[model samples]
Target: MDDNLIFAVIGAGNTGQAMAGYLKLKGFAVRLYDRSEWRFKSLRKHSMRLSDEIVSSQKIDLLTTNLNEAVHGANFIIVSTSTTAHIEIAKRLSEILTNDQTILLHPGRTGGALIFKKILRENRPDLKITIGEFESSIFTTRVSATGSTVHYYGIKNGVHFSTLPAVDVRKIFQILKIYFLKLRPIRMCSTLL
Candidate 1:
């Protein structure tokens, strides 16, 4: 378990920042990414706010504006942005995603996962990548009063996750349980209906 597994959070928004900080707090290697370089400056601000909660000097492994740098070597990439941008993000990811990487929308909208998976398949027929989506964001989050720290308001239980290639459910769950203890794998067939 000590093998440095990299977790990349692909947005710098409230949900993404909190997720990344909490993951870093939990001792996982984390990389934070946003298209804007200015958003990358969040670490210096978040680290201080999370200091009391984490009780240790946990910090994100890297922060970058380049998507390629963010996803490279990341075992799992969480697309924490709003579902509105899933298509655009999917297009970008299809271009550089490696075969070994797995990506999932933090909170999937109707048919969002399938749409994303379809794009990946069409673009990279040569690669077998795992894709999935959560029923909703695991953490209800917002920036703190200080305006730098992401404050998690709540954790909803029984949150469902549906992955592509239904057979990979167990494998994907094993990966997610490491950080998101609240996730429960549900039938992809059932969710589609």
Candidate 2:
């Protein structure tokens, strides 16, 4: 796992779309996926409408409805769906994820990482995976009025994250810093102080 470039932006909503565009612009190979392939059709139409040309899916590596195909060989898997879908996605990912791959539950509001851990463990107890989470998504973006674009409202002032058990906090911080300008490191104890 390179852990530096290839990324899986699961759930191709506004955040996922924006992440796909932004990360691609930053030179990372990005794969976009949703349970429904129709979700990507709108992105193509919107890109064509805004650019007034053929929207080449080639701009990104692959966009598919297949979870296995989307997440294959990905170093970093960022789940961008609503929290309500966590368990289902967890179950799906458990069948595919490799231990070398790290799964980040962006905006892991309450027990998101653990929820995923439990579900994943149920499927494969022998698999040990690294997990990370941020209190919120690093990006603040939305779909345009015409639905042809993702309007990025700039990154938040500060984005802090933690890796469970704290062994790889530094590495997680290092990786996130490349994509998030406002990336901040937080001490788990400091959160309680």
Please tell me which predicted candidate would have the highest TM-score against the true structure: 1
Q: Candidate 1 lDDT, tens digit per residue, 78-171?
A: 9999788888899998998888788878888567888888788789888788887888888877765554566666777878997887777788
For residues 42-113, could you state the per-residue lDDT of candidate 2 as single tens digits?
665434121212122336678888999989889888888999999999999999998778888777757787
Candidate 1 CA-lDDT value: 0.78
Q: Lowest summed lDDT over 10 consecutive residues: which window, candidate 2?
A: 48-57
Report the error of model 2 at residue 191, Å: 13
Query: What TM-score goes with each of the models?
Result: 0.88, 0.85
- Which model scores highest in lDDT? 1
Q: State the lDDT at 14 in candidate 2.
A: 73
